[model samples]
Target chain A: MTSIATAGASVTEQHAAIAGARPWQRLVLLAVGLLVALGLPWFVYPPVAMDIAAWALFAVALDLLLGYCGLLSFGHAAFWGGSAYATGLIAIHLGVPFPLAVLGGAVFAMILAVPIGYLSVKRSGIYFAMVTLAFAQMLFFIANQASSLTGGENGLQGVPRSFFGIEAVETDAFFFYYAALPIILLGMWAAWRIVHSPFGRVLVAIRDNAPRARALGYDVERYKLIVFVLSAGLSGLAGGVFAVSHGFVALPELHWTTSGEVVLMTVLGGIGTLWGGVIGAGLIVMLADYLASSGFDGIGIVTGGVFVTVVLLFRRGIWGTARHLWLNRKRS
Target chain B: MTSTTPTPRCALRTEGLTKDFRGFRAVSSVDLEVAEGTVHALVGPNGAGKTTLFNLLTGFLKPTSGRIMVFGDDVTGMAPERITHRGVARSFQITSLFENLTPREHVEIALQGLTNQGLRFWRSEKLLGRRRDEVDRLLAEVGLTELADKPTGLMAYGQKRALELALVLAVEPKLLLLDEPTAGMGIEDVDRTIELVRRIAEGRTVVFVDHNMHVVGQLADRVTVLQQGSVLAEGPYDEVRADPRVITAYLGEAHSA
Candidate 1:
């Protein structure tokens, strides 16, 4: 038998190297991100900035499943909106602080994700998307019919924001933005930690080749379900914050369109890059706010045009493509 | 039939194993026994159920009516991962790997399975640094030490195949089922793989399917020849190669090709 060294230089190594972010690059990106996040409200309207923060978290949460786990969910609105309603009810009925209420709603979303993810993870690609979409639509119908509990078409309004019994927020959007920023930032940090963890590597393995992962002794379905639940809980955190910040949980929150919008934001920013989603959420929210103020009813047309361009031109999404180029240049 | 009949120590055994796909029998009633600590090769023409048998042994497919036992425990109809837990590991005929992951990452993921920490999403991946020595050993064992940090997508087909073998070795299974360990390889890679398999097969039972007779001749301690999903002959490689039925089966496949 020959030792491996002698077989030696006979084998050819092919294919382009996939770029990885170094520790310094990640730290620098994080610092820049913190600066932008803190300085956004100073430049933009406080309400719009609040929407950006909430939606950014939502997009990051969705990207956890879609980009990392390779599971595309078309009905994430269930968790986002479901958490909003749960958070609103908890705040209004229990009179707890906003953070406690938000945490409670996020937990509720995780519980809901258990069954949906259980059934949906068995499926792949378009079928998985359809299963999630169907479940969200069913929840939408139920919320509309529950009338008294959900407040029917009018939604749950006057969802007060209290900070440990001290009315610090006091129905002030600007003040609420600073408080919610930490929670949203926490959710993003959790998402980042997950993708860089051992479990996240397994999720990527499963995404790359499920049967192969199974042969390696990992439970592919269980991993998928775990990530799905985690993503939902994080999304719920964002939705809960959005509800209390706006002091309302409306029908549009649960609508399929909201689900579509978040997907758009994640893809536009970059599906697998956690930061890409924040950039995406920020871009879409700011664009929509600007368009609405300009009395531009065709906001969809412009957003749709941009989405088409991104899909056609920058297939890896904004942040993904940028990082790819940056890494390639560094290598050269 | 006698009470004094001696049973050999077998690493894997199948009794009346059969698989039917919509009334078409891919594998007929097949009883196979592989003694412990040997290289066993399954060779047949295309569509003769060689891969199917490998799949059956690995729990990738449930037999229609049969029993599969590994190291004396019945693993019939068990899940693929459960079969792995029972000290059986397999490599795919086609290259199956995480394209974006590095070879080191691949070995780490497989090594993680041995521990209960694979699901620790909250802990840093740097914790896997504890297994750094073992991971390096596996990568170097397969001659991928230099390219260990490169993503598999950028690797040659042969390098990817070598990585697959490394992944299987990381589990340190008692029995290894390799499907076409040298399929679609250049002459040099094929020779390298043959020597590599010979080195790795020490003290472990190996069951592999290959179209390359050279690989079979060089590595197989025993050969089981299949024809139309049934065992046509079984003996040492030299004896099996001399059998007329085995020769005819090979000739038949060659003619068709």
Candidate 2:
């Protein structure tokens, strides 16, 4: 306990000492980030840029649970894929507009999340992860077997991007990119808002010391369940958007690997920092794109190598480490 | 002798509070009562069920067979958080804290819990700015104003205990269960903690378990000594300390000399 306290104290002191950069500096950084995000499609494939934005939103959703709530979910793809299927089914069957379809999908994911989170939040750490994974795998099997509804193993295809009677996004890549940006940005902002709220502070308190939080009259499990559902809703929203943008929802979206990928994105960018998810997602997506285009078949090996290096050397992932160094330098 | 009538002055009471772990009988049919606004101390040699009994009272553990009442309300088998909502709060023996959070944030979060706004994900924590003065007062009460902005993980051992006290106080609890608040503190730290407890115990009921005889001697208005699982003796510190069973329990027959 003493050793932990000493180490924590030093880390705290370091953060305090390097409380550098004013509010305007952060605003400028945000502006630069927005410009980069908006301008990226001109330099790269527009669809790829859209994929990064969608995945970044997905990563942020997972971070709400993993980072703020201190829950490590290994089966978030259940919500992601589950929402993708829901959005596709809604758009195809009901002929609803894209935004409403996405909302329907997100709401469906949240409904699924309620029971899953209820049972899963009962356990924590690896057990919690395993329970969520079990439920997700169950959903994956159902999606596979209900082929008529989900298109089964063949995947759900031809999810239209008709936003309020405008079908321009189907042929124009830039239109699709612009349509997806606001949704992704809104999802990210909501996540940011949650983490900075009183509710978010309690979630952090729970993550730090659940027993203490309980002793202080916070229903720790209830808080966890709420965050879990919120995370699933956000992930579902992202997945819904992705399904519409890509015009397909496949079985791979529900697979465990997809869940693992988001975890990697969160950790690689920096856990707990909101924007770290975006940076991490951008890096991974761009890297994978670059690798595939360059005829490099070992993208897994390269991604794994980067993950290992970041874990060992930076410990805070790419953005967190960079922020730490920047703050320290500013302090000096 | 158990009283038939529930006294408003009695802040906490337990009847036949028995707990068994695989038939090990950690605590057996113990009846305990604490009056309002007094510093009550539970002490025993190791494995005397001090911690277990504390857990049972604070709703951390369910008694195998018994009833726990706080201020005339049956709180037995209630959830810990429910118990806290009924004006009971506790500090852990191991110094539990939100290590990554600052002392100010810790107090703020605790204060937020009191406002029942802990689940408000849509509202900014800045809305809690209305409670900033209260947060500062708590930090100052714990003598942590200077270090309020420092992360609790970085706090010194004594400071952590103080922070824990402030966190408990933030709940505005009528009863504070402090488990070994001065367990591993140095003399100065111990003295400071005792003083802090003394100041806080003025209007609150404090039921603490302490291994430190000096702290118990200084602060405890009443002392209960346990041997094995049952109460060995109960009285003011001098009388309990003078009990032959307690003496035998502590030093065995050799030290009874």
Best by lDDT: 1
Lowest summed lDDT across 10 adjacent residues in model 2 chain B is found at B1-10
The per-residue C-alpha lDDT of model 2 at residue B208 equals 96
TM-score of 2: 0.94
* Backbone clash total, candidate 2: 1
| TM-score for all models, in order of appearance | 0.94, 0.94
Of candidate 1 chain B, the 10-residue stretch with the lowest lDDT total is: B1-10
lDDT of 1 by residue, A212-291 (tens): 99899998888999999999999999999999889989987988999999999988987677778888998999999999
Q: iRMS value of model 2?
A: 1.7
Per-candidate count of clashing residue pairs (backbone under 3 Å): 1, 1
Model 1 agreement with the true structure over B1-257: per-residue lDDT tens digits:
12222576789989999999999999999999899998999999999999999899998899999999888888999989889988899999999997667899899999987666878989998877789999999999999999988756678999999999999999889999999999999999999999999988998999999999999999999999988899999999999999998898899899989
lDDT of 2 at A47: 85
